[model samples]
Target: MSSVWHARCAGLMITSLALFAGTAWSATISHAAAPAAAHSAPAAAAAQPAAPTYQHTASYQAAEAKYNQIRALQVQAFDASECIRKKDCPSDESDMLRPLEQALVLKRALETAASAGDRDAAYFRAKVAAEESARFNEEADIYTGFQDPAYKRSAGLAYERAVRERDFAKNMLVAGAIDLHPWSCMLYADLNMAAQPGVNNRDAAFNAYYCAASGFADRGLKDLALKAYAGMLKTGHPQHPYVLDMHSRLLNVRPDNPWRKIEPSGLVRQPATTSKTSHH
Candidate 1:
């Protein structure tokens, strides 16, 4: 009887231990599985990025199309203006008024784009305004140069009107320059020069070109800055000490400038180096 009781007690203890072990194992498995599920959830979410909606895509595509259309028109107007300027196509000047009319249209479009927050369009519009002003000024001169009294009288009035419009172009040029448009700054500098007859303001022209050169240099456009610097030299002011110093400084900064290198006269000379022989 005693042996049978001891055997029964041992069996009961073994069964209890097995039950406890099974419970502990199930808890461990549940805890590990929970962490894995939590980690996988964040990982899965992180793998995906937000995508553009249909409306965004449509709006972007529309803007791109409009921008491209305006660019094409601007290009066409630019080419036509070039042709008119060169007198390569007199017919264009007779009817379509290649530069002024087409440029005016482009100007308006560019203005609209600028108003809509397009900076490049504003710069382009400023350039067109400058071109229009120049063309008008030229036309005014041609008309005033007419030998006939009747033509001269009418053309003189036109010339005065053009001069007034040219003032507006100067304002546009200033606007573009303030916006840091390099080409506009150049045109502005040129317009302010005393090179044209009856317009003598050497001081103003020199200052404008100097400012442009400094701005371009600050923007890492050393080449363009060099051009503006050269323009200062072109102003009978080449002998000025300041001009000479600036030119020398720029040459030192850019020894291998492509534009300057292309000019055979501006080539820099290399100094000969002599080596000493050592006798042992």
Candidate 2:
């Protein structure tokens, strides 16, 4: 495999593995306890609803198994590529083909399961398609030495398909599923960033930020989540009010706000804009 291909595969694999843990966050809303009259305590307790439960179905389980298999093969391929690069262990290019082939088979299984209304399957299918698109684009870059329009066009078509698959999967998902697969939000964000900017881009960006921020918060990365929300608010998008409201609520609920102490100078800054005359 090419170096670019290896890097992309390794990066994505690490991210997926890190975020795929089965820990579930609370599905019910939490409220602060308040000092109440003794008589009202029992009535307040009775008013709370039971949290809903989620059980993975047989199809979802099967699809998950297949997805795991694909990930394992990808790891093997990535290892082989690294060994070949170092020339420390004998590795053949053919070793990488196994994972690519298995991934395609897994994609088909995921597609079938997704069509049957399996939300997890839909998510996995979208991920597979996105990976395939990345692979195609990287391969095209290598094969053409980054100069061939035809190859780029072919890769672009694959990207379009990946986007469609991602959207389909997103439509099938619920909030709980999104919490379980927070990486999906980041994946969607990447796709939107790559897309040509339009009216939808603003909403898509906000949704991605919101979902990812919630995911981070659920995982107890409150500072990271707060920073994301703050950045969203700074964008001055039409959704600024909503971002501000969320930030305010987060601070209200968590009094030990780290975001207040964070300085703009510590964050990454955008490159300074330049005029055409300055370039000369």
Candidate 3:
């Protein structure tokens, strides 16, 4: 399939997942309707606390605006690349490189701000690096079919930097009493997975899967978490002891039947748990 098609499919899948999440959330609210109705109006309002809001600093707002502009250029670059692939539009590969260079410039500026303790800049910088890394990988796939080691190495380094910046941002935000949303946690897991790949990075892969599973569970997506755990066990990529430890932890915290017991080899004894969750 063309890269454009893949991008379209991914967008569609994301939309579907959003719908699914909304449906699941509605179901959860419905299940609590009876108990919620038992309380008086004021008591019910108190029980269901309002969502907290944060005020962004002026510096953060300025940085965010620049980030948005950079992202728009990045999307144009992607479209240009796709046009080249189709051979249906007058496009130069240089069209793609120009925006990437701009992104790098912005990334450097953000780095400076991040060093001065700007958490929002740090987050935007991580996002730019991650997207740049993904674009590098996509270029290699579309043009060289993974035959270029330089692209792979560059992608890996960019992803690694993204993870570092994102971690720093998270720490800074937490210290400032800012709570991270579930999507932020999921993005961290994605960065980890992108940074570490295949058998050579088993420990890193384990960390990625562990992060993903735990984040999903904490977000009330236990079924998705179980699927992540199942992928870990089926691959047998992680250390046996670590797998066993994770199994035990899941059983204690989530308490699902599939994680009820573990085998000597650290594999779940029960049948594989399935999730209805869809992904791009």
Candidate 4:
């Protein structure tokens, strides 16, 4: 009986070993498939990138920016050529305006593009050219007419008026050249100079005021000049040498202050044959 029991126990142990071997074989097959599946995707990806190349949005903007800058410069050159042909700067020996002159050039380029049926291109060109041109224009306008008495006189007054107004005071001089191109710079200058110290700045202020008031008048800035003149008087620049006799003329012609015969009269009210001021 004991020997029979031992043989039965040995048979049970063999059956358990076979079951464990089958499970181990199955686990090995399953793990091998997982690695193949994971590796296949990477291998395919490494073989080649997707069909369409990738580009970030920054690349697009960068390309556009470069094109606009280069094309705008080209168009600007073309416009300047046209301005040369038109003799817009009549004083120059060449048929062209100053090389730095830009506004007219930009407009000319736009017209050329429009004539060629490239209205969209013309529009974009004008927009870009204007930004570049404005910088030059602002610079020229500021320095352009400084030598002219009208502009200088206006600046003188605007600086003084700005003292009290601090903000609105400059309007006194700018009022004279509302329609002028170069006039705008002096107006801005007048506005800015008002904030400067009055000690060393007084002479300049007086000069600008007189010029703005009188210059605009001569330049046909009639209304603008009148306001500039009035503001100068109110701001205490009326006694400035350039303004003294002129201011007196304006007062004498006034209808409200009892003087009727003098204000509108020219500073030199004598016959046109009066002795001329020295030509410095």
**Maximum-lDDT candidate:** 1
Each model's total of backbone clashes: 0, 0, 0, 21
Give the per-residue lDDT of model 1 (tens digit) for 88-199: 5764743434434554565676667666755455545554555555666677678777788987877777666556655655665565566755656676777676134698
lDDT of 2 by residue, 80-124 (tens): 787777756677778877777876787777777776766667766
Task: Show where candidate 3 strays beyond 4 Å.
Answer: 1-63, 76-104, 145-188, 195-199, 205-280
Clashing pairs in 2: none
Choose 1 or 3, whichever is better by lDDT.
1
> What lDDT does the true structure give each of the candidates?
0.65, 0.63, 0.63, 0.51
Model 4 lDDT at residue 182: 23
RMSD of 2: 30.0
User: TM-scores for all candidates?
Assistant: 0.48, 0.46, 0.39, 0.26
Model 4 lDDT-worst window of ten = 176-185
| Sliding window of 10 residues with minimal summed lDDT for model 1 | 52-61
Candidate 4 C-alpha RMSD relative to the actual structure: 32.0
User: Which residue window of length 10 is worst by lDDT in model 2?
Assistant: 24-33
Residue pairs in collision within model 3: none
What global local distance difference test value does model 4 have? 0.51
Error of 4 at 196 (Å): 24
Could you tell me which 10 consecutive residues in candidate 3 have the lowest summed lDDT? Answer: 174-183
